[model samples]
Target: MPHFFSHNFLLLAGLCCLLPGPQNTGASDLNKKRESTQCQNFAPTITNISLFLLQKAIHWPEHTNLVFSPVSIIAAFAMLSLGTKGNTHKQILNGMGFDLMKMPETKIHKCFQHLIHTFLQPNHQLHMTIGSSLFVHKNLKVESKFKKAAMELYNSETIPINFKDIQAAKTQINKHVMKGSYGHVLKVVGDLPIDTVLALVNFISFDGVQIGEFEAERLDKLEFQLDTGKVVTVPMVKRQGKFYLLKDNTLSSWVLMQPYVGNIMAFFILPDVGKMEELIQNLSHECLNSIHKRIKTRSSNLSFPKFTISTTYDLKKVMNTLGITQIFSNRADFSKAIRDEHVKLSKAMHKAVLGVEDKQWEELDFPDLHKNLLPDGPSVEFNRSFLVILKDITFNLPFLMGKIKDPKTK
Candidate 1:
């Protein structure tokens, strides 16, 4: 398990909310138009933050297999900002790569509301759930306004608990997370600090079935080389078909786009030997846009590993690096959340889990000639470290991103 500190986890834990129903026919269209505009304005910010975190997370020590939900982290902090004041509020928004003057606070929340609602909608191909739970001290008096926004916008549940009873509080939090993630994430809080007054948790769960027409019997152990020049054997899935592919000489990387059953697209980026760092440094919003625009369909043979990866991060240090330090310091101001006393966030922890299904396909007998023949076109094999992004094509936003260094590593 790779451990790092960052503010993205809260967003994942709090990414889910109850789907809002239409009040009436007259207001539905107007509300949707407003939400569409907000989402269009908010999509780029989410992409920038997702890519930025992906770059920072890959550099963390022992992060051979990394996975996280950027949408969840953004939503969690957007809810937190509702309770913050002064510089604390500014830092949270600014750290998320949002411009206060252009977007403002209200618009930001509305945008998040729209984004979360989109994810909660029913999809036959994808099973996804996003939700948030706020465990606050029993004595703490939460402002009505903050509570209302957290519930309405983020669908966050604020449950008061006795902070003195640490074990009970911890159990309650873990239970909420477990239920939210459908038991994929068993425990999020092992221990709660003695002085802890509030614990904000967010979780997101995704299960996607591949829409690629690949023979399951093609699954076999293949060589996966690490950056250290060591190759290990692992189960690799093979597919041959027309795919949207790109070969960027400038970045020395091959980008392969794979679609799932839903409108979800997964972009697998395999850099040329030892070019991972350069690819990361050069990757930007515009570069990604160009890649999306320029990728052409071509017949190719592709092989990618089957693996499951999870990450837990302590976001205090990471937030500080992003210029969000006030929330963790003595000068912290959460006046809007709790007006009765001074409260500074002591700890911010985030954990995310993602799995690509490994199906068991029975072996089939085939002729020697058919087995030996290869598909016509370029052969791209992800038998090494690479980046994978799960994006929603509808909104053009990234929900999950990760760097897979070793398929065998859990």
Candidate 2:
């Protein structure tokens, strides 16, 4: 039997545990009272509202690590002040706090139909959490000013005393996801709406993917260079209206980087950098070569999405940062399997395309395709802003796990 430590040791250990003391009974009482009260003013400030949400996200007794579900957080804010006065508002708030959000798309007010639909659109985890927080937090300030000014104007108007101004704030992402939606994500005008597409155009201004009457001559030269590996100067054609990538496999599709990052975070729920690279390599060596050989003998001119091959060294650097270490056992077998699958897929695709005409390709426009431009573009400019999100998740994952810090870092 070992001797116990003195009273001083017990007191010091207890102090370090952060357990609430008897002196702070009133603070606990206030929170306990808040649990029962339906006070509109409880989360009045951005700080308070954020703290309220953060407490649920980080400090909840369950899942002690810094694991916050972005979907939960965004849905929480989206539905937080939905209909404050009626049972609808209460329901919305309740829905936010719940684990799985069946977005009450039907019940949302008509004026906020877009907002309701926006909730249905898929959002990146970090984007959803941070953007929704900023969205509600900003509106808290705006509504504060607006509330003091317009009682008579509002009362005189036809609508009811519906102050549930579903804060109509738009981040860079909202432009694509909420613009022309039918299912959750709305459709948009053209590829120009995608950030990376715009960035690419700015980086390398070319005549549109399709050759028009005016662009016919310049496009001929460009096509020649692509085919023969000979340099040719191509002229610029000012696109009067928006142009979508005329139907072809999206060589530079945004699916490469983003979903990969999300999947790693989401534990490979969908494709990410590693898979995308393999797909790209396969497309270039097999698909592009096959297309290249076929088109050379064709009477009609050819068109495909232009892309550049980075050196193996450059590719290695990009892959490493994205955690793309090639596992020894799986890659070759996976590639072979993928190749076999693509072979079958290609045969089916070719059979399906037998009756289709060239114009059909041009008419193919993925209006709802929200192309991610991050990982597809040049590695030099892939913005590290998203690292903040991954970093936050990192620092918090340990806390969420309830692991003691090295005692030094803490």
lDDT (Cα atoms) of all candidates against the true structure: 0.72, 0.20
The positional error of residue 347 in candidate 2, measured at the CA in angstroms, is 42
Worst 10 contiguous positions by lDDT, candidate 1: 3-12
Worst 10 residues of 2 by lDDT: 345-354
lDDT digits (tens) for residues 372-394 of candidate 1: 43557787888989887877765
What are the models' TM-scores? Answer: 0.87, 0.17
Segments of candidate 1 deviating more than 4 angstroms: 1-34, 58-61, 209-211, 215-217, 362-370
lDDT of 2 by residue, 356-406 (tens): 012333344433222222232221211110010111111111000011101
Task: Compare the candidates by lDDT and give the number of the best one.
Answer: 1
How far residue 169's Cα lies from its native spot in candidate 2, in Å, is 14
